[model samples]
Target: MTDLVRARLRTTVLLIVAVLVETTLGSDLRIAGVAPDFMILVVICAGLTGGTLSGAFVGFWAGLLYDMFLTATPVGLSALTYCLIGAAIGALRTSVLQERKSLLPAAALIGTAAGVLLFVGAGDVLGQTQLLGAGRAWLIRVMIVESLWNAVLALPVGYVYAWVARGSAGAERVGSPVRRTSRSAVPTVK
Candidate 1:
């Protein structure tokens, strides 16, 4: 199989696994009434590994799938929020951010916090006022705790995402050295 197809298959499997874990064990893993958002973490990983288009694509699907299991908000809310966040992260990764050992955790920290705000803000704008019914204090708590949780989990998740995305174009740009064919290196005789 080609690398693109293989990478896509791996990513799809990873998303399903993330959803399952999030739905089944998420609550149990909560600290101070906040649970880790596996879906967003995966989106962040996708952005870090793949760049803008990849991030947005993965974010939309991941959010849509996550929406199916949600009852509190409209179907496309998560999709929009995640897609925007993923794309933003990807843009930053390509433009402003430098690759480093700490990149994953740092991105996860900031991305998750932004995601929480975006989700709540979007939801409220869409008439889902209950999102803020808990008030700013609760929202702040969720943002901080969830960001911390994602940061802690980022390394392992990022490694797995890198493995899954191996051989894809964006993965090459982010994680691996590009291989130059010998034919390209040989100078053509005039």
Candidate 2:
């Protein structure tokens, strides 16, 4: 199989595992009444690694799968939220964000915060008043706690995502050989 296909397959497997972990163990790992969202983390990683289109595509499916396990809100809500977050991250990655050792964690911190706000805001706008029933203070608390949680987990998760996305479109391979044109083929501009 082609490398892109293999990469996609690996990513799909990772998504399934992330959802399983989120549904099974994520609830048990809450801090300050906020749980880590592995689904959003995966979508963040996809955006960081694979660019806008890939981020949106993966986000839609990931949110859809996650929606199946959710009982409170409408089915497509998460999908829309995730898709927009992923696309925003991807766009930032390509144009504004610089590559650095701390990129993943930083992105996770900011992205997760934005995601929490967007999810709740959009839900509230769409008549899901229950999302904001706890009031602004609760929302802020959840946003802060969840963003910290994701930032702490970003390194390992980002590493795995980089591995899974290897050879896929827009994935940057570490230590890849630089293409050097032969000097002899070009006329010397003496």
**Local distance difference test values of all predictions, in order:** 0.82, 0.80
Candidate 2, residues 105-150: lDDT per residue as tens digits?
Answer: 8888998999999999999999999999999999999999999999
Candidate 1 segments exceeding 4 Å error: 170-190
lDDT of 1 by residue, 1-190 (tens): 9878888999999999999999999879999999999999889878866777778989999999999999989899999989998888877776777656677788899999999999999899889999999899999999999999999987777767777887675553333322321212211110
Model 2 clashing-pair count: 0
Q: Give each model's clash number.
A: 0, 0
- In model 1, the Cα lDDT at residue 18 comes to 91
Q: In model 2, which range of ten residues has the least summed lDDT?
A: 181-190
Q: Which candidate is the best by lDDT?
A: 1
RMSD of 1: 6.3
